[model samples]
Target: MERTLVLCKPDAVQRGLVGQILTRFEQKGLKLVGMKLRQFPKELLEQHYSDHKERPFFPSLVGFMGSGPVVAMALEGIDAIAVVRGLMGKTNAREAAPGTIRGDLGMSFSNNLVHGSDSAESAAKELALFFPGADELVDWTPCTLEWSYSVGEELKG
Candidate 1:
């Protein structure tokens, strides 16, 4: 099993898609280990997206993220990293395929509705950032061969 970080960005909350976004993952049979609705202070946003700081669009990205509340979650399952990203779809909404969270709800790149860890290392770092000092992120031992999975193996975080 792998651990991954899942973020339902501000747009998801603002658009009242929190339940829908979560249902996608839950229905996929992935375990929701830890979660919280956090108004990420500027300080934390800076850390979470520090890698993008040098990009020209970084400021706008940061501002948009801090503008509202987001749901931070810890997901556990096989290939969870890839699973979440596949469900989130492309970073650029225009390219996102239908049926994905981003494809279904997002309209622009900057406002893309969610962010999943892009790599395993990043997932660990993100989990720490959003759920520090917390364990039991997931109890995902399901005794079954078939389970609904939201992502494919290609998008491994």
Candidate 2:
């Protein structure tokens, strides 16, 4: 199965939307391989958002992210990265589709409720950052696997 990183950002945790966000992914058949709730260090946030270091909002972005506890998750499924992104909707809440997490719960661009890895490379990097130890991730098959994908589809994973 493909794996991806998903984060219920500080705003999501602060607003008590972490359960709802996690449910959306679970109901979509994504398996949770690793998860934790914690207040991240500024240094970790800096490394995680390093790509945005040159952007004007970099400082504030990191500040907000580290302001409270975040729910970090490592999920696995077929096309997990794309699936999580679809569920999260657009970065701009106003532009997100009605049924999406952001569309339903978010109200601002900076305070968007969640984050999902945008590509395979990102997934790998983010997962490693959030779940550094080899033992951190769990391996198992979901009972619903058969119902979620066909035989041929399961073979792809």
Candidate 3:
């Protein structure tokens, strides 16, 4: 099973849309394995968006992220990295499609409201960065979630 990291950014938390955002994933058959309500320190946020460190928007991005708590998650499923991004839609909410999370809810580019790992390698790096050492993530069995999984769990009877 492949795993991807998902983050409902500070805006989503402030807007009280974490449950709504999460439901989209759960309904799409992505298995929610690890999740938490947390905030990143300045240094961690800097490291997480290091590639953007050189970008002009990096300071604002860091400030926005540190503004409030965000929901960080680890989801397990087939092709999870891409699947979650597809659900999140374009970074520019204006350019996203109607049914997508960003299109439906977000506004500014800086406040895109969500983040998902962009690739398998990124998934590994991000999951570790967001969710750190053992059991930091909360585990819960979604009742009847056997219907959603990676590998052959899709063929469940």
Cα lDDT listed for each candidate: 0.84, 0.93, 0.87
Candidate 2 residue lDDT tens string, 32-88: 999999998999999999999999999999999999999999999988999999999
By TM-score, rank the candidates, best first: 2, 3, 1
Worst 10 residues of 1 by lDDT: 145-154
Best by lDDT: 2
Global CA lDDT computed for model 1: 0.84
Off by over 4 Å in 2: none
Better of 2 and 3 by lDDT: 2
Each candidate's root-mean-square deviation in Å?
4.5, 1.1, 2.7
| Model 1 lDDT per residue over 54-129, tens place | 9998888888889999999888877888888889899999899999988988888888888899899999999999
Which window of 10 residues has the lowest lDDT sum in candidate 3?
Answer: 148-157
Instruction: Pick the winner on lDDT between candidates 1 and 2.
Output: 2
At residue 36, candidate 3 shows an lDDT of 85
What TM-score does each of the candidates earn? 0.87, 0.96, 0.89
How good is model 2 by TM-score?
0.96
